[model samples]
Target chain A: MDKNMVTNARELTNTEFFYGHKACAGCGGSLAVRLALKVLGQNSFVSLPPNCMSAVGFLFPQISFVTNAIIAPFAANAAVLSGIEAGAKALGLKDHHVVGFAGDGGTADIGIQALSGAIDRGDRIIYICYDNEAYMNTGIQQSGLTPYGARTTTSPAGKNLPGSIKMKKNMFEIVAAHGISYAATASIGYPEDYLKKVSKAAQCESTSYIHVMAPCCTGWGFPGERTIEIAKEAVDCGLWFLAEYENEKFTLNRKPSSFSPVKEYLMKQGRFRHLGDDDISIIERHRDHKWEKMLKNWDS
Target chain B: MDRPKVVKYKEPERAEDYPVGATFKAGHLVQTNSGWRTFRPIIDQDKCIKCLRCFLVCPDGAIDKSGESLEIDYDFCKGCGVCAHECKVGAIRMVKEGADEDGR
Candidate 1:
């Protein structure tokens, strides 16, 4: 809902895009979608697929979307958005925006092919992948988007295998490789940067891919309000980086002042409740690898 | 991999400026139809006891007191429905959409 703390303009404003729906007390996905829609405004059409979003927003007359939202299948968010963009043109509609909001399970895993296709086609639509690690919607199962060594229903904590075995997919690089006009990574913690990137993408005439690292309080077993705090922790720990690529040039938007220890961040969440020194060390090594890569890119 | 054909850019001609309307030129396509949703909260005045819970809890300055009636901007409402939730008397309900169907 218009979370723009600075604005008081009131004229048919929708504060909550998808309200009256069921979500945990502190649902980062809900907040991320709402904030992204606010930035896009009334002229935008959101294409959501089957996930927590679709389930929460598109359940019959109980729709939470306050504007011109269209429900697509779980995997068709990108393609549907492309069609909406085309339809917008054919109908002489200007000042309209299209957004494909998908979960990381949908974007980094099941729906990646369609997303890649839309970017490859250079369709002028904005796509935001709300990365909450595991697929919290479908029983908190592990998906390709889940980070390494993070507990999930599928990847239960054990002596040998604490959580997920593989690291999270490098989605920003993958989308950037498509040579799209705009690609960015953001987190809920950085509102200005996130809003700025969304505004920038809206003004562009080519496809823009935005990956937002949204923390899941229910999935992570943290307090509802702590969603934002966890989001900040992820960024502070260097486990998450906010950056954008314009014309293939990488720009690091927010770099960590001093890297925060990953253990403390993990300890606060229930999903990481099983983590010990070995798992902590593994997570640290992974974070260092990502940080070094980002540093190298920034320097280059 | 086949390198998809990239269309060449051409300068858009300035059409006779109108107050507000859609225009198109050769090789230019306008995005007309947006499939996204915008949410607004409507109050059941009968149920509304002027509790003003919505006005105080609104994160986006979309809510205001209009005389005895509470005024909410459907256009600017992100549809978060915090106002509806905060209403003590079950006064506010989130409406399906803002504006009309014609894209006015």
Candidate 2:
């Protein structure tokens, strides 16, 4: 009933999302889908938009899911999931978990309207945005979610200009502003913590939104094997922070004893390789400033 | 000039499929396969602590428990090595696809 909450051991039962599809060998978004489905289980129905995940994870003659799933429009993932939740209720269904699983581009940029509407209307769904920095599915295009100083095909670093001049959009705060029952920032590196949060969201009455940092090896120009490693490093260096909001309360899940240098995090990805000392200092200051702001908002 | 003949056939007399309107099937499997992997994961029973982390972390969802052991479905595993990479006990090893008889 409660997805058989695993206590001391990881359950041996199979998950809803399985292999067979055409995700890249080192794809992080696919990995995130697998973990999310593991917690949501077969009773959940996920909405995949026109992201890298929809392209590789689900397509024509071949599909990867073992449970129920639907492919939605790029900007209509949240909209479609809202309808599914409404329909599920109308059918006198019980225990149906409708989830909108979209990419950074879909969630923060294209699909924000439907996402915001669904959250505002208080739909019972868990909207998770697996952010891989850029629109990686379409040949590394720059999206609003792409972090500053990162290179995308649309915002390539050239002679005079550095990569993305604008900083990343803060969507978690935006979701929290909606007075959502559950909103959090999670990373692929923290599976236990991430799973716990998703499960908690499942039990909540209001909509839940989790923005997860999913490192992309191909888009980030790193070896596929370093996907989780980079995700962990991002949080360790304060490049990304893990925190949650419930009932208007805030708590930081991770606050490193001593923050790792931002250079270690930036240097690992080719997207930020062209950054010089001045750019690095700017990024370092940005991270510290963001962390200070989060500290102030902590416990609010 | 030979033109194909349009023969009247039985209209496939079955409930052709509509997701919602009034006809909808509750559940079905969507597991298509592409296991073109050169290497596959093999969990050694001796070393496994039954932590189930491999099954939990496999991107392909190819790992399953067999009795007190775990197994990987090479037919669907894409050789991502994520299971092996995440295994803390080193119980899972990625072996060459055809190395079963080579005794490596």
Candidate 3:
């Protein structure tokens, strides 16, 4: 549904958040951090868990950060951000924005408890989950966020339950249920909507949670160039919706009048290559059910 | 000692502009037209057991081995540490530009 919304590489913020650091070609995690940090500027402190990000930047005194950065334990990002927020307020420096960036593994599974506590307690901070659909930091292992029928190291396609059997946990809805001020699903495919949600989250008075779908080129087994394309097609096919929830009201940002088949989105990545006719039918049924439910809220 | 086998990027039958025996040093970094470039992930042959884990795990096909020693082509290697993580024998070490974590 996103039409002509991608940003040219030139218009992006030139900050060196991950400069001189190592990431795979077309690494969406890298781009997500770069752009997200650009919106949440130098005054922000990043509480990163032990994910791909910790390995992407330089270590210790030779760090690659232009802003204050802290590495929390694998699942303790939210707790650390809570502490930072409390500490900053105690020091009369509450203006400091504490941004908690966690991968899908950390967010949906390991760090979910802490994230829920922070939001429920009304900690003034923004939490961003750069979901790549698997535990890529730990050699492509399956996580709670892995989509059904996607291949991961633990969920390899084979005789029984060919790929990941369980559908991805509906994290946006889960976060919304906590009564946060803002909750949204975003994708790197739609830069303007992505940036707009990020910018709005930055200014919100209460806790904000933004879950972004960042395409992983190496783990997804796709060419580096298709990163943006695949992300765009996801929204087009309605597999991933770009919508926001504020104060119990759901607003579908880009509601498609008519969406393409989910197969168009799935077939682009090798992770979904093993899906058969029945699997595709099941996915369509699931997608239609979810989309219809979401549409009901915005329909009248 | 294998003397860290030297390789020259030459055409099949023509002499390339690159100098022979120039030796890609361990810590040297160059600023190309696009951006500043640097050396990363130096391999210690003594520790290398030729397990081929580095080759198999390289995100980019930047690693090329001749069955005996592994060579890293920095042109395509973005320096992500999938190889170093997969290297169980502790043969590959990520040596940043002008830093001494080698013996650490």
Residue by residue across A1-300, what tens digits does model 3's lDDT show?
A: 233222332333433343433566657776677677766777888888988876765442234445777788887889999899888888898556789889998999999999999999888889999999998877899999888899998988987785999888999999998889998889877765777787778777778999998889889988664676777788899889998989787788888898888887888889998899899888888889988998887532
lDDT of 1 at A4: 33
Give the alpha carbon lDDT tens digit for every residue of A1-300 in model 1: 433332222322334454444555457787677667766776778888877877766543244565677667777789999999999989999988899889998898888888988988888899999999989888899988888778999999897898888888898989988888999998876655676677778777999989998888779898654566688788998889888888778889877668888889989999888888987898888888878878887633
For B14-78, candidate 2 gives per-residue lDDT tens digits of 56632334222222224433345766777777888878776665555667655446766655667
The CAPRI quality class of candidate 3 comes to incorrect
Q: Least accurate stretch of 10 residues (summed lDDT) in model 1 chain A?
A: A4-13
List ranges where model 3 is wrong by over 4 Å. A1-12, B1-104
What TM-score does each prediction get for chain A alone? 0.93, 0.95, 0.93
Interface Cα root-mean-square deviation for all models:
14.3, 10.4, 14.0
**Interface RMSD, model 1, angstroms:** 14.3
Per-candidate Cα lDDT values, in order, are: 0.72, 0.77, 0.73
Per-prediction TM-score: 0.73, 0.87, 0.72
User: lDDT score of model 2?
Assistant: 0.77
What is every candidate's C-alpha DockQ against the true complex, given to 2 decimals?
Answer: 0.03, 0.20, 0.03
